[model samples]
Target: MSSPLAFDPARMFAVFGMRAVDSAGFDREVVQAPGDDLRCVFLWGKDCYNCNVFKQTAMLHKDALLDLGLTWFECNVYDDVALGQRFSLHGVPAFMMFRHGKRLGRISGWPGLPQFTEAVRRLRSGPAAPPAPASTQ
Candidate 1:
């Protein structure tokens, strides 16, 4: 495997492996799923124990995610701090969802694959409800 800092989208499938691509590649596969596909970006950092654990969980639940027709990508935050910052990611081992170049939702932290799947399901279900309207003068 290449250095953790390198972005390689192809290696994202391997255990704890994520594409160490540059910002452009990150835009292509991650920011934009390209052809309207539901995509999931696994945001992690080096030396992050929780990030490692989350990856293991993703490896185990790969099938489940596939069943949901979700495309996966691995993004090392340290490799692209800008991207992480843009997504408002303040922690490692975060999951960001996107479709047709638009962000759907995100779930941060290691809440287990089941919970992650559930959250993704929610994201897939439909748009989140808007806040109640404020009273008019």
Candidate 2:
């Protein structure tokens, strides 16, 4: 059988990884936007099976989203402790979708590719009117 695809955290991090968001910026960008067409953030703590699954799913969707003019941000739990605490991320492989800085949706654990795609679609479509205010508010 063909060898399993290698898991290169460095490469993945480079491609999908997020930059350091200072406390103020993280609060404004991730915790304070207020619309449907917001940004997408993926938080990963460890290189576990679930995180791997999500990574693959993201890879599949990355190109499509790029074509659609969508934005995605990746946060390494080890690197972003302050952001992690802000989100109360006690688990790895967590997915959070935001619009205008407000959290539109969140999915944790390994839901596989299908579920991940669905979550993205839903978030992209925006919350069903009357969305909650930004996190900072």
Candidate 3:
């Protein structure tokens, strides 16, 4: 088994086997670059409890997620303050979806594995984003 995370961003990326990107990468690769695959950018922060939970739970199933055909990248909002601001992110463990260098949608927290994956699936295949839960409306 892999070592447990120590709340360090680099360790977290290595542990989760996720590609870590900075604001420059986000702007260049995500905002400007074109791609056929749908993209999901995971936004996380240091020492975030929910982030750890999602990393251990939802992110652990990323191989299955990849099979569903969306590309994934992660960013540490704690280090990339500009990235957080650019997305208007209010919390850690969020998801920012994109398609062909355009914004698609965002999910603000770990909303359980099934729901989150469903959202990702819908975003990748359909034109509409998953509707906000009634509680948020």
Candidate 4:
């Protein structure tokens, strides 16, 4: 894959109307440490077929995001290497949820709309952090 920094945010926003960020933008303000709105970051690869499909799916459901007062963005892992590294991206077409600058949840690959919405609902309702690791007795 190409360097993640290579993706053009201008072009991304122009084409998708969804905020697309490079490493610089990613670090600047795309995520809020103590943010008020729920942020959904979609990580994709330019050459990934699944990413293309997910893009369409996301667009179709964008109103749902807006109604939920969610902020959605797309990042090309190929162009934003640092962001991908930060998220430890395992594959393309992954969706991650964030709020208050904290990651709430992530669901990899498209699991269909019903399942996807359920995941989003869970993310919106769940605590910012997962429960602490259990102690081994």
The numbered model that scores best in TM-score is: 3
Worst 10 residues of 4 by lDDT: 7-16
- With a 3 Å backbone cut-off (N, CA, C), the pairs that clash in candidate 4 are 4-79, 4-80, 4-81, 5-79, 33-100, 35-100
lDDT of 1 by residue, 31-110 (tens): 64446556778778877888867656655666775677766677678978887887888898887788756778888898
**TM-score-based ranking:** 3, 4, 1, 2
Q: Cα deviation in Å at residue 3, candidate 3?
A: 7.3
Question: Candidate 2 on 1-137: residue-level lDDT in tens?
Answer: 53568655545545654443544576666656555455666677665666776666656665654454435566677676887787788887776766655566678776765665666776656545565678984
On lDDT, the leading prediction is 3
Estimated TM-score for each candidate: 0.70, 0.64, 0.75, 0.70
For all candidates, the clash counts are 8, 5, 0, 6
Residue 20, candidate 3: alpha-carbon lDDT: 75
Candidate models: Cα lDDT each: 0.70, 0.63, 0.75, 0.71
True-vs-predicted CA distance for residue 79, candidate 2, Å: 3.6
> Model 3 segments beyond 4 Å from truth?
1-17, 59-63, 127-137
RMSD of each: 7.2, 6.0, 8.5, 8.2
Predicted structure 4: lDDT: 0.71
Candidate 2 residue 31 C-alpha distance from true site, Å: 4.3
* Model 3: residue 77 alpha-carbon error in angstroms: 0.7
Looking at model 1, which ten-residue stretch has the lowest summed lDDT? Answer: 9-18
lDDT value, residue 45 of candidate 4: 86
